[model samples]
Target: MVFSWRKRKPRNGDKKVHHMELEIPRHFICPIALDLMKDPVTISSGMTYDRESIEKWLEEGNFTCPVTNQVLTNFDQIPNHSLRKMIQDWCVENRSHGVERIPTPRIPVSSAEVSEVLFSVTDSKRRLDRCECLNSVHKIKKWGLESERNRRCIVANDAAGVLAAAFDAFASDSVEKNANVLEEILYVMNWMFPLAEAQLLLGSKPSLRCMVWFLKSNDISVKQNSINVLKELTSCDQLYGERLAAIDGVIGILFKFIKDPISPLITKASLMVIYHMVSSPNEKTKAELVEMGLVSLLLESIIESEKSYCERALGVIDKLCETKQGRESAYDNALAMPVLVKKILRVSELATEYSVLAIWKLSKYEEKVLIEALQVGAFQKLLLLIQVGCSGETKEKATELLKLLNPYRPGLECIDSQDFKNIKRSF
Candidate 1:
């Protein structure tokens, strides 16, 4: 491969023969992979290699050179531009042989550039061309995903507020005509979210209300992105959280997402946001969620969800079970106690902890609930759970329930069946 970027002049080109040739030199190949370097880089050991190959070596904890076996003090893989140029030119010359020239890779956006975009995006009154401003912010968002440094740059410069402003601009202009722009803002928000937040600020409540309308957007990605923004704001941005939750139909809309989630992540975010809102410990909020029928939805999620989803589902279930209405909802359902019992040892430790706690609550709040649980064969599962051994907290909860049931031995015997044999010996 030719490493020279200088094109051969016609003075030397005049002597070229009719035949064409493609030749790659040994030094042009990476010693590590023995292949032509795509992005050649030199390590501190003075050994050059393909950037991908050398990075993998360093990541795997190899501090010595692959070729020289010399100790690498810095292990910095500096890009070999000259080698890249040579490879690019060689491919250009070998175009007839099906070799394709690699395009130049973009350098990551710098902190200064991010700062400029933040200033421009936030400076709403500027007479500057609007499209150019949006395009610059878009590039910064793209760069934020490029590298950790770029992400820090964008976050440190207040990407959240920038995105909110962009959202407000396009949304105010014309939602249908400018929806493409709104989607871009959502994408940027999704990337910048769960980032540096002390400097970041959500938009005004009016603009935030506008964001709520996005929940109905037909695009699944847009819906997920909107939920992501709401989740972050509600969890970290206290001012925005309360306002977002106060919007009409917020709980019902989110419940729809939970019931018919576009993706597991959306479902998880919906559950987490609900969990945060319910954590206000407000009697009204808890009652509202219970009134919205979250208990049955959470139960369905538990039965169908995977391990992580099950953990989150049970988490919400545990929270909802704190209210009288929540318990009544759970107890009223025939599947409630039986399904909660099934997850005791079937899912994760977190799930088991919540499941046991829910049962404990039912038993503690009302003795009839405990007897009902026993009548449903909960004692059999509890018996197996304690004997099999689990976390101390789960074991403690189970032990309490068993002690509660020990006095009801005759009731337990009446409840036991051949499917769960030796119920008498369990205690």
Candidate 2:
């Protein structure tokens, strides 16, 4: 067969060389991607592919080799150094024809290297050398961002714990003084979540108090990340929530987040933090949330929230309505009835449950709520929710609500019903 090469004149003491045409050798193409392999690697199936292509396939939860259709015996990707060298050489030879040489890929980080980095950070912190700790943290953050493998290794090496110690140490003593170090730690720790151990470490009084200070930061990223880390810390531990809530102005700051949202993520996270705080909450805590206008905020958020957030906002409302002051605050809001009625069967099952439960709670104190529910088509939606599916508690709540509104069912024509599709369309 004829070759797809064009002869080139010899240079001074240089041998004759050939330049490639548009056609690339079939063997140079990755089996999976059907393109030139930038970083060719061989797998257990003896098949070679570009590293990214194979990684994408495996990341999609695939267990078999794409081309060979054989189950992967080993996940290790052994680099095809010989083939890569040849490809690099070919690219160099064909440079005049617009071919570019692929640079060598860096080696993946090893466990020992991560251990060294971890030691440097801990050693710096142990020595009370802020400058050394800052430098080491920056270096580890760079290493973590280099590759997925490096990130996994860093995580496996308890980087979150290392960062959390440094974080809590500074936060406990003087976070404001070393604001850059604290922010950098948060920036790195944001990606290393399930931070169970880190949260436990940060659950101390001083650390939690420092987080409140960070929440009031002028910088939005600092504020957002501070809340994000706080959310994680308060996720499962009610004691932490109680301590955080007791930190004067913590509740007010959360209210500010909802009243003037920094971002959608911050808003949702704030709601979640409130949700956890309310779990097993004392009478005093519930009253504090209500007095701070949490009921009206929850209603406004439910009205404005998408489906994903509506459930959380409603859940917080449901929790608040458990207390006397919470029910009173919810009743004071004009949108309370209309908004709660509108959510029944209109959002997810959880949203519907919360709406129904809130209605039941509000109607116990005020009889006008039942009449308002009937007028706003809550009766029809309650009928539909019972017909369709919902939790047993939600079903029981809907049943109870139906009995409460049974006295006003005669004016079906006046029931201002808006379907889910219509409400979603408006959004």
Candidate 3:
């Protein structure tokens, strides 16, 4: 007997009908796993998509629901691939106590929708005016409400909308209004919002005040966010003497994370921040960083960390030993030279070349140090680098350093003409 197959239809007044109607939209689907886009991919099709791309999108909260166009703004919406194991362990611990999963409130808007709304405000002047008006309203309502009243008021005004506007203002090319709006947003976010939201908004500006505030916070999320902001700020010209000067104790705080046993990204970011801080223009800051035992930390990291961290730490050391004060700091601390030399001898060929250049620079100030470096086969390393025609700067510096080391040595006759010819060739 043949059986007739039919798809089940929802009956009227059925509870399951409501659940079916609330199905996730196709556009909200995550391309990677074909799920309900748990972690929304934020990049436009034009840009390169890599692990870093997904990470940045997650950081900026760019994922949206396909149907509602609302932002999936919660941290949970994005998979914390790095912390998954930790979270699983926590869940297991709670399960042992018979605790059940608790539901979290969904964010009503997405970052993309907010950007779209801001862009809809056509005239730039009018857009700025409207944003300012909205900001003032937010501030006034914030001050007026107490307890849950404030929260309800904020929700009523649409916190996500206001935040999106604030971000637009911060990214505006008009420096005057951008800086002001950024500062105000930071104040509100840090003092009022929950830690996650505050951390999300930390990317608005990388000012000195913001950096210090993030550093001083007891919140680990805030501290991590601050490390990112500091890295960005230091890379820009806005890194002034005053700001660089304040980074003296920053390295110490970062070092605390070395033993954290979780979040290698945090440790990596901390090292990057230290690298930038030490490489800044302010001598006192650089000197203080070295004095704070940065060399030892970097040395330890070199042996312990993987290639990327080791390379970055070595770059930091190179910068540290570039200047007179940095050189003296290394010399005063006896352990610096030996560790540096050892790294030079052991790492990749590129690292060896950098080490040779660093040693050449050190030789300029202290001949004895140069002799010690030479005894570690510095000359042989430099010769190999010169033969391979590594960096032009490295070659020239080595040539000059060789002249200074032994002008009357046997192979010195052709060095001056070769140096001149290389300079001419470059020109």
User: Which candidate ranks first by TM-score, i.e. highest?
Assistant: 2
Candidate 1 wrongly placed segments (more than 4 Å): 1-37, 42-79, 85-104, 124-132, 144-182, 198-200, 203-207, 237-241, 383-392, 411-427
Ten consecutive residues with minimal summed lDDT in candidate 1?
1-10
Model 3 poorest 10 in a row by lDDT? 418-427
Clashes of each: 3, 0, 4
Order the candidate numbers by TM-score, best to worst. 2, 1, 3
The per-residue C-alpha lDDT of model 3 at residue 392 equals 70
List candidate 2 segments past 4 Å from native.
1-26, 29-38, 42-47, 52-78, 81-104, 411-413, 420-427
lDDT of 3 by residue, 1-427 (tens): 1112232445575545222122323443344334332322233332212223344455565675333445555433333333333333443455434333322222334444434433442233345664654455344335434334334334444453445344444444453445445444444443333333323333344344445545556666656555555554454433432454464455556656553424666677766666676666667766766666666666666765666666677777787787676677667665555555555435555565556566666777886775555544445545645665656776787677666656333442222222223322321
Candidate 3 residue pairs that clash: 30-37, 70-110, 71-109, 71-110
What's the TM-score of each model vs. the native?
0.71, 0.81, 0.48
Candidate 1 per-residue C-alpha lDDT over 1-427 given as tens digits, one digit per residue, 9 for 90 to 100: 4332322444555754343445678877888787778878888878789876886787789889998889888966688898889989987887756567876655646668877777776664143345765676677767867666567567767777666666666566656665665677777777665644421334455556656777787878888887887777667745565666778878888888887777888888888878777766566767887888889878876776688888878878888888899999988777787778767666766787889998898788877777777776778778877876778988998999989977776835443454355433321
Look at candidate 1 and tell me the lDDT of residue 381. Answer: 78
CA-lDDT, candidates in order: 0.73, 0.82, 0.50
Best by lDDT: 2
Q: Residue-wise lDDT of candidate 2 within 273-351, one digit each (tens)?
A: 8888887656777788888888987787778679878988998898898888898887778899889988876677778
For candidate 2, list the clashing residue pairs, or say none: none
